[model samples]
Target: MRLDGARVLVAGATGVLGGALTAELAGRGARPALAGRDPARLARAAEAHPGAPTAVFDAYDPASCARAVHDAAAALGGLDAVVTAFGTVAFGRAAEVGDEVAEHLSAVNALAPAAFLRAALTVMGPGSVIAAFTGVVAEHPQAGMADYSASKAALSAWLRAVRREARGSGIRVLEARPGHLETGFADRPVAGTAPPLPPGGDPRRVVAALADAMEADAELLRTAPDGTPVVERRAR
Candidate 1:
């Protein structure tokens, strides 16, 4: 679990939380490979962190996801930790949201990470840590966030099942559910779907907690400002 010189891959590297997390991982002596859908943004991040590997990946494409993981592991010589941080929130009533948008959001939010984790575990040996970020809304439903919440909830469910399967493999599976963060996600364009989050959410704290949990090999329920877990361990 020690991050010192650990080889790590962070998906959604251009995203608000992902950006902060990449920095934190690098600071901890982990060689972080950046992956995103945007070539320009990926190039920028790579330029900012010279010697770091970059991979172009679309979360919806399982082939691309597998390839990226393979290449990143190769580039870094080996992979120790893989962080699946790709996310999308489409704000609206579930019925009001179009089918296409709903499917896309679901794919990005839930299916993407699920597929990524599967691919990662296939190639990743023991002592590898896999971290995926879910949302607080997965636990507490919101009227305008029905689709978003369901997608995150599905992701949480998927992680829990995988955790049980991977328990004996010595491969750690972690789920981090962070609440409203100040990272301007509320302002960006998410394919004309949900709006970004409001300001004042601390990205640093979320990333810090995630880092600590990963290093300590602890399963966590990361929260927002109020210290409430939007996500928790599901009851048997």
Candidate 2:
């Protein structure tokens, strides 16, 4: 879809990928509203994109997610697109994965996206889209990543379900599963857990895929550095 004159809401605006996505959306002439967990970081990013809307939101909190979606839609006049790069990844062996780590990944990666999509659809009607970031681990599972892989797999499945439910609503749902993001996502610190970073991956190609698929109304599928794969899930 042509980004000009579009009103987009970007969740996880503070992260490396989210930061790049936000800048790309703004550069394309779309008004981007940032929704993040930290007000300070949101304010800093918002200042860079003057007059753009920003909201305090959490991926695990359904109420906060709903409020952020509605508030962003209202602030930007209407929500044309929503992109989520939120969630965490912990790289521990399946046998070593802890309850806290598993819960965090599940809540942020799976539950949050489902809840956010619900709120986004409530405000947006036709000609809108929802794109989220997933990882190739969902399909080609790894030995050292149980919680992370499962979370992304849940997201991919959930997006397929969303596409089915929103068939007549004119709202397209897409899941972007990129491999080995170079972004230091897994390098971050997490309380009560420790896991090394997965193989480094590219962020530009991933963001480009996200922009193109969401803009052009693609199906629920994953993207690789090599090219777009033919996933079995259907798109209406």
Candidate 3:
């Protein structure tokens, strides 16, 4: 989809990566409507782009996720893209993590994004793009992050299926499954401490690559083993 003047709604605009992406999208001439769980942070995030619309949603409430999408669509007059860049993380052995933590991870990481994109589909037409950030853990689950990985994998699987269904309508589903990023995400896990990790890939480069992928109508964006961003034109 064309970024120039495209009306885009970025869920999780309050996050580090999300904030950077919102800035990048705005710089590329896309009009961005910011959405987050916090009204105050949402307001602060919108300050970067004066008059950019903002919506609030609670990830735990699926209805709020859909409402955020509709609210942004209405505020923007229409939407050309909807991107979900928010998720929660937990670090613990599969057996040690509590059911409550597992539920929270699934709600925020999987169901919430699905809710946002499902709502976007009704308002968006052909040529509109829908994207989400699913991490490498989705495909390569780590021992300490079982539930987190499962949640991401679930979303990834859902996206894969929806891509096939949406293909005939010309809607693009871009799944960004990049490796660990230098965004301090691991340091803020909701459960057990993060294990020793190598230096992370550059998130800014990933952000730029994501914009390129969207413009090129690419289906996947991932990080190479050497920390470089790579875009796959067609997803296998």
Model 2 stretches astray by more than 4 angstroms: 189-199, 225-236
Tens digit of per-residue lDDT, candidate 1, span 1-236? 88989999999998878888899988988899989999998888777578998889887797888888899989998899899887877666667778887788788988888877788898787888888998777788777877778888998888888888988998988888777777767555354454544445467877877887788777655775665443333322
Query: How many clashes in each structure?
Result: 7, 5, 0
lDDT of each: 0.80, 0.79, 0.94
Which candidate number has the best TM-score?
Answer: 3
Candidate that beats the other on lDDT, 1 or 2, i.e. the better one: 1
- For residues 27-88, what per-residue lDDT tens digits would candidate 2 score against the true structure? 87889999899999889878879999899887767999989899999898889988887878
Tens-digit per-residue lDDT, 9-49, candidate 3? 99999898899999999999999999999899989999999
Top model number, lDDT: 3
| Candidate order, lDDT descending | 3, 1, 2
Which residue window of length 10 is worst by lDDT in model 3? 60-69
- Give model 3 RMSD, 1 decimal: 0.7
Task: List candidate 1 segments past 4 Å from native.
Answer: 189-200, 224-236
